[model samples]
Target: MKKLVSLLLVLLVFTGTASAADLSPDVRSAILVDAASGKILYQENIDTPMPPASMTKMMTEYLVLEAIKDKTITWDDIVTTSDYGFFLGRYGGSRVFLNEKERRTVRELYEAMAIYSANDATAMLAEHIASTETAFVELMNEKGQELGMKDSNFITSTGLPRNILSDYAPPISLGEQVMSARDAAILARELINTFPEALKIASTPKAVFRQGEDDQVEMINWNWMLPGLWYELEGVDGLKTGYTEAAGNCFTGTAKRGNIRLISVVMGAKSKEHRFKATKELLEYGFEAFTVEKIAKKGDTIKGYEKTKVLKGKKLEVPVEVAEDISLMVKRDSKIEKVVSLTTVEAPVKKGQVIGSVAFDSESDYLREKDKQDTEINMVAVEEIEKASLIIRLFRGIKNFFLGLF
Candidate 1:
């Protein structure tokens, strides 16, 4: 059985593969991916680079959350609004109307930036974290590179178009911040996976900042397409929005329905409404077209992999079962096919030791030649296999020798 199974694994690995769905979305640059698997479900010019606008704040928000978690900064730590950050003046894209020398807590600044998309508040927070906006932008780029965001170059912590006199950029070069739709999706994925709490603020349509004070102002989230907003889409939580003359209207959003979560990015739409409309269409297309398909469940035995030989063990063989529940986002129209491979191992096998794996692929004849979209899980030993006693091992060796003589 081991010999036969080994031969089958070679065939499955080499001869079997499937292709992805060819979906044409309505947007200049867009991508929809499964948040868990990072699988590209649909894309249109996803690699095309464009200015990301305020979506760049998501990276700032992520770094701030990291500071909070690591104790480098506390939510209640007061941050002073430097004259440079406070005086961006009305000309700056968006602001919380912070006053120079005014102090506020890290939590308030974070809320202001996340909900209001305030450029002023973003600058203050950047200065607080790194003592200067220039140093903070350096941190932003370093983190982006670490996240494998090759196409992202964040010049501003606020994601605003770089301006010569504004603190967001240096006094010299004036260049727009840029990122690809695919890269934005990757950044959003990292943010959500690492700090899910950030979504609570991103999804909120409105909140009060500096409450019950002379400077108190209501900060309404710019993202109106989220749930509880003007145009409600169930499960549409986060993440950020961006717009500049060069970038046009851009949005990077995420939604979760049941066990499946998806990230969608749309860049360079004609208008704010158009960006949201295009994003909504892409997200709807994803949920309408794909579903979570269960490949295997924990403790379930593989049909052909009932047992594997255990050398020098009290038991000659041991039962094997799926170690984890495996599932994948699959096109509803495609059929699922399984490719199983079980490995035979020597004894002293511990319970839960991985001994093999199974992969699931699309069985649609049309996708036979397409790129493979599959998810796999390991098969594990269900029970421990202790070494056999000396007498038992000797008896087995003698028996095998006699059988080989025949």
Candidate 2:
């Protein structure tokens, strides 16, 4: 009995140590989330706003992509370097030197910004779109609000500290820009979903800024976890990294293994190595501990919600099923509860008309309250329902009236 008690104490101590290590990452703030569902898998101090450093450029990247999508600009459009661009090239923290009045295609500048973290190129793209970095910052703030990045503030397009910008800084009095880890994950998830093409430029490990030009420079991606890089991880691709005295070392990284894509943020790490290491730990934990389970198949009716009432239809009701496959990234071996929300529809209902939604509620501690709604999937009609004739409608109204009285 004495020996057994001693062995039990040893096991308890070992289990406690492992739990503590799993909970602690070597960073001031970190978060992990499912990119598809926005379900949070892990988070620590994620809501506290902190300087995001060049991760601010992710927002700049989004706006640039938005401009392209809206036809406000094109990849081949030539933009002349503004005086501000020249000034930043001279003083910006990470830059590809630009001569005043120098001409480059939007694609050129975008690649520089995406792959090299070129502040000059980033600022030039902003000026081309909004005519001034300060005005461009306004657009950033507006989009931030639209995207629900409530904890973010953008002061410079380049994410450079105000001191580095010298007199070229935005006149806003709101102080330095900061974003919470949760907000950063949100932005990253939106970026990939809205502009998946952005990943093409982001994943390029190396490219020449101006091939065969007199002053060409080799641009290497700062996100070193990408393939063929020093800390290469399989499926690691396009994302952003940041560092400043104020922000420490930071990274907003994403990876896709099979059908599961995960977004992770690590902020205020001791060094670049530590940041990537922390991110790798988060990614591995997510991939190993959770899985993308298809809880509801497309066109399959939910058990308790097989049919919904419809007014003015040839048939009084129509069969409804999920419009698309409902997959949730949930803990392995965990049971999921299906929560269905439905609405009544008037007929002339199309075959795939969305009339309701189905969302999963997990009892797992890893999921957060705000992200619960992210798992919701549209429930749609399985077949068309034509409008009822006037006589049929009158009969149905009388029947409903009698049913209500009874």
Candidate 3:
């Protein structure tokens, strides 16, 4: 009876303190980050670069969304399929089977690319937007650099194997698209933040491409974490999945439970099932271990934010405000300290001008080691402080001069 009790105690201890270390995922790299704060929750080989199959489409999606935002393109805009795009689909790659000279709307192509992972549709959209796939690839690389994705290099819109386009007799090995797990998370966050509507498209479990009376193509979303898939989990919504001979199986997944959102990236997994399994583990660990709380709202006045003296303005001083909402993810049941600091602003201050910052800190060694304990939030001026009239300015200058002499 005592031995049985001891065995049960050991099981309880392991279950209570379970972490990522307890599970072994057959993947080359993986990472999980708090979608709101971009704080890494769990990681393994996050910096190692691996092939990024169709995951490259996220950048393509970003550019398409940007163009729409700037009015350069619209969802209703007709995209004329180029010969290059047609040939890519014509050849044996995954596509919506776009014929040469086929005309499709921007929205249709985006759905194909985002939902079906259609290589032809991706190339078609790229050519329509940039006049050529090569130019679109250049844009993708530029955006990657802008996003600080140091370990990523995008040579194609589709994450297809490099040699697929090669004419070499011996099939000379060309470099494939590569990205670190950390870089993938950064890219995913940017995608969801910039055009959250894209998630609506990605969340679909199955969609019909070019739905019509003729040649209707049935497209299934590759993300198994979404509903109706083998690994369906509540709250799992968006993301992209990729696979290639070189890349193995990869997935960039995100889920929101209440106010907390998480982004998980798994790359180079042994199989399709393994990649989704690994991602689920990371996400479950994050949701189980941490909770995100809204510490402050944007424009909320910080307690004790004293009015700053203004040299020449309509009012003698102005109230300070938070520039943006502040939210932090901390370990469950852990306590933290919020430290607010203010900086005095000079006259001629404009509304929303940053002046100070608030920081969160803790003495917990575990929090410090995980690099999750401390963070800073910026403060801004709530109201504008106009410059005084020339006569008033001159009078103040003379008064200041006399005061300085005294």
Candidate 4:
């Protein structure tokens, strides 16, 4: 019986390992994450940086949106094509065939870049914002660092290879624009969270550029998983795609179903079809295997630490409750452990003031170190607690002193 049991255990271990290996996407690097909680569900070689191709435009898009939000520029602002923008628009890898010194509104250029991935439009926007593409490259790197993209290097706003730009290329020493799958996903998350309206353009399947003009062009989005596209995965929406000799094919995709939204990145696929295929696999696995579970609701009191002692308050103890709802994306069958730390507060405490914190740890392997901070929720005062009268405080102090002596 012992020998038979040992053999069964060995088989189970081997099968489990093989199952995990089989689920890894067939790409150079990939990662899937819950958009709300930033929990990593699936990851493979996510930190290895490689050419990101046109996906670099995401940073340009972010900066443009930032400018608009800051009121430094507006969608209706007109931008004239610079010498570099004109040259790149005429001869760059992907373009809308912009004429030298041609003028277009920020809205038009933005649509061209976001929906069509037009390299020239991207370059024009960069120049318009920073007075030069080289200066814009500095802003991109600065923003990347702020976003905690540890393995990313932005050499071009359009993600075009430096050689393609020839003399127009920024004077940066880096050879090319590169980002790891994790960084790409991080950018995607930040972009959508910070500027959700971006999806309005990114999800657009088709549009006309310079409509009804001699140089008009029809722009079709490269993301195939969007609704009404070839792959047409339900709930799949706004994102970006890229391809280059060095980067192969790459995609950052996002989708939402019910209350759960997921972001996925696939880099270095052999073909366009393969990139989307890998993304679909990652999304399906995430949707099927995990769910966002709400462990505590706003105002729910922590069980054992429901009341915290308050010094010099009308009431010696004040009730405390969670400040925000705590939710986490966890495996379907996994168990969760709740750990809490409570603290005392001085009197004159206001309702909603933080007094403690609660953390929920799950028995799953998908959690990452960065996500640790997100799993905790603040505990706050459930109601106001004003300081007691001086006479009452003195009497209470004397009573406590005598009690301590006993």
Estimate every model's Cα lDDT from 0 to 1. Answer: 0.78, 0.84, 0.78, 0.83
Writing each residue's lDDT as its tens digit, candidate 3 over 1-406 gives 0010000111011123546577666689888888866777778888888889998889899999998999988999898877766767777367888888889899999999999899888987887788877788788889988877888887788877757765311123324578988889888988998899989999999999878749889998888778998889889998999988889899999999988899999899889899988888888888887776677678777556644556566566778877777667766644556555666556788888877766553332211222343356777888899877888878878998999998
Task: Give candidate 3's error at residue 401 in angstroms.
Answer: 23
lDDT of 4 by residue, 111-206 (tens): 999999998889989988999788888999999998888899998899988777778766657655889988888888889999998998899988
Looking at model 3, residue 266 earns an lDDT score of: 89
Hey, what RMSD does candidate 1 come out at?
5.5
What are the TM-scores, per candidate, against the unseen true structure? Answer: 0.83, 0.82, 0.76, 0.86
Number of backbone collisions per candidate, in order? 4, 0, 0, 0
Estimate the Cα RMSD of every predicted model relative to the unseen true structure.
Answer: 5.5, 9.5, 10.9, 7.8
Provide the lDDT at 66 for model 3.
92
Off by over 4 Å in 3: 1-18, 167-176, 296-325, 333-356, 361-375, 378-406
Q: Model 2, range 319-379, lDDT digits (tens) per residue?
A: 9888877666766644456657777888788998988887665443332355666566888
Sort all candidates by TM-score, best to worst. Answer: 4, 1, 2, 3
Off by over 4 Å in 2: 1-23, 304-320, 341-357, 362-374, 378-406
Residue pairs whose backbone atoms clash in candidate 2? none
What is the C-alpha lDDT profile of model 1 across 193-307, one tens digit per residue? 8998998888888888889998788977788787677757878988888888788888998999888898999998888888788777777777877777665689988676788
